[model samples]
Target: MDGKTLVRRTNFTRIIAACAFIFATAASAGPTVKTLRVDVLYWSMNIPGQVAMRKGLEQEAAAINRDADKKNQPRIELTPYIAGDGSAGIERQIAQMFEAVKRKPDIIIVQPTDNAALAAPLRAANQAGIPVVAYDQYISGGTLAAFVTSDNYQAGYLDGEYLAAHFPDSKELKLILVEYPHVSSTVERANGLLDALRDYRQPFRILKTYEAVEPNSGARAGAQMLRDFPATGSVDAVFSVNDGGGLNIVEALANAGRTEIVVASIDGDPKSVDNIRAKRLTHIDAAQFCGPLGAEAMKIAYALATGKKVAPHHLVPVFPITSETLQLYPGWGGPIPPRFAKPWQARVPYWEGTVRPAK
Candidate 1:
């Protein structure tokens, strides 16, 4: 071959080899994903929020993974523990909390069964340098990396407003308040209802504040209360802290052939919406955005787990749902109402810190 042709061939081979070396180095330097282990302790699968939280967590994890793929960041891996229904399950929930802590997961997200029962285990988790994210309900004495929940107090307050505006006409308003004080969320709800009731122009007395936590217990209490006040004319209105208790009250009143009582409550359970649609005694339900609450908790947990700065408290908003307004409401275990538009006003107070000062 000619000398010039030989030189060109040698140069071409050297350039090809250099290109191969560059490609190999680039492939070897590809991004690494940081995987985190997240432990979730659900109070009860029967409760809507608890179950919805699981769904929301999965969604949030997917979003996080997608974003992580784009930015090449960490991905979350969740391990969930569900405690079943009723008062009988409280002990089991506590046991599950301790068990989760022992596993030493990087982050623990909990919907506490009782305000006090889960505190110890949560404290232990914190002591071990594991961040705890409280969802739906707060743990009174634990160190939390973040707290995410519905604006429960606002939920009850909104319910009370709905009842007060459309409250039944009675010589003297006799209201029955169904409450369960073991959890902070319920207590706030009860207080919010009372706060709104206090603004009412009419004279009203709380006939009784029955301690019923869930629907079954609420039903039992409602039945007993009805028996005690069997006259069918006693309670002018009923304010239950959650939808479960409100449903119980409706059932008790219906069986007794009384349709005079107006029921207002929190938790937008699908059954409660159906009752409203059926023109039952239930009047209003303050719908909590449970999916959003769960999603926010997942976000906060991810931030805490990854050593990022986050707010001490993150609150999901709530809105009032009535038979008239039901068509526009969106909540858990139900389809988004017909022409649902985002409730900008409901979100403003929470986002702008206007409501935080009141709490």
Candidate 2:
């Protein structure tokens, strides 16, 4: 071969070798397998939030796991810490987050009781660059990567509307509100009911408000209220923040032999459905409270862990489960009203009973 030709061929070979070398390096450096750890802090094992987490979130996490596995990507490890009571749960969760910050968990799922408790730790996590998703309750003035919950105010307003429709012609109505002390969802629901009822010009009075720590406690408190109030007149309605409280109120009324009062509560658990069936509780406005919120929060957690962008807030919608509809869908909560959209309507199947197939 001529020297000139040899030199040209040598240059071409070098270029080809360099290109091959670059390609090999790029292929070797495929997407890094990220190790994600998620910590879920919840109020109790039996509540709707925890129920959702237990039933729905596992499915979402499993889907994420499947996707990651297909791409030969890092797996996500989810760890849940249940605090059992509202106040204690919040404190324990805060402590867990502080410990997690040190351990550097990729994601933390938190349900704070109120704005103040939520802000501090969330801010600290944000400053440390750990992404946090707040669910079941809203946390104000904090850099939460995402927030997922039902429109609590709307749930409460619907409770009021149900009561209004149930007792349109009633005058001199006496009402009782059974509540939990420091739960953000409960507080929001209570406020919504009171605010909606405030506009009524009828002779309605909030006869009493009782705070109960446990579900049955609300019922006991409600019974006490019933016995104490009607000595002079009658209680037209009892509004409970949740089904547990509402069911308790119904039990209280039944025990007191004052079954005439209309009982309405949130959550469409089987017990509440049974109450509606037996003509004990009049109305139930159940949100996709547990499963969807739990599942979506985990989705947000996975996104944050993988450094993906997510919406700042996600509102899970709720609907009313009345007596008429309950009769149609026996053995579970009634069908979602036709006016609602997807996902919200999809939740009707999940909350048919107290025990559902795990997600």
Candidate 3:
């Protein structure tokens, strides 16, 4: 070949080599390291279940990062915000939700203070293309990418069933109900308890229903309940919505010398379980898998933000704990007990649904 033709062939080879170099660089680059901003908003840090849940979520995030590092994947950055105090916590949470939207976070995990109160802000967040995960308390009116909570209805049913079995011989069982109506979980729990009682073959009467909003208000409500129903009255048992309220109710009963009254409630709080082990007035507590609830929510949120398939609703399992079963439970603040036999042996399973599609 001529010198000019040789030069042309050399230049063509160089061009092909350059293209190959570009292709190799692109192929070896792998996926881009993505940064996901997650806002974790809680109604109140004072709530034991919420506190445990928050801890679980933090641990989950750390675990996710560690695993991602090992597998050469992206990491998550969480921004946590707590409502100032319980008294005005709901309003503060709403404000925080709006602020989070302004900051444009990729996802939000929240434990709503009220079922309907947080709806508007959460709906707005959905409209802005941000996914929201409801943890602990269910938001009745918002669009949630996923909801993670214990089977509150089942817990209440179990508590009521225990009460029925204990008082089977009584012809007319008089019971006091302590409930918090604002929260969806509490509402479901209350309804479940009542329904279980209704389904009981024996006759019963609801002596009174005191609105003990939460554990914080338990003392006052418990005290009032004691005053309203004298020890000489026909009060057989008390079904409180949660362990917090149940503890206060038990205290009031003790103070009023009304130790004969049996108490059943939700939340497998450690203190409450200890009371059972010690043979206190509180008989049964529905133990929630609190930490697992949070951890599960975190996992679902991560899948959702990453465009992976996730269940729209996730129900953590719960079981009943009494004096006989206290030793078998691991309490509500952690995962299911390794050695304890699960009473309700089936999982609710995850269901598919979008948080809320755009209008």
lDDT of 3 by residue, 1-359 (tens): 99999999999999999999988998898767888899989776666767788888888899998998888776899999998545488888889999998899999999888888789988899889999998878786768888888888877877776776677645688988888888889988988887776776647888888877456588888778867877565698888888766777777787787878888888877877877887788888887877777888898888888899876777777767877666566665554644443343223222211122212
Residue-wise lDDT of candidate 1 within 49-99, one digit each (tens)? 567767877798889989987887888778888777666577888888888
Candidates' C-alpha lDDT? 0.77, 0.67, 0.78
Query: Please, what are the lDDT tens digits per residue for candidate 2 over residues 224-276?
Result: 78668755336778787776556666776777677677777776667777777
Clash totals in order: 0, 4, 1
- lDDT score, residue 288, model 1? 76
Residue-level error in angstroms, candidate 1, position 157: 0.9
TM per candidate comes to 0.84, 0.78, 0.85
Off by over 4 Å in 2: 1-29, 198-203, 230-233, 327-359
Model 1 residue 228 lDDT?
71
Query: Which model, 1 or 3, shows the larger TM-score?
Result: 3
TM-score of 2: 0.78
Q: What is the lDDT of residue 223 in candidate 3?
A: 78
Score candidate 2 by lDDT.
Answer: 0.67
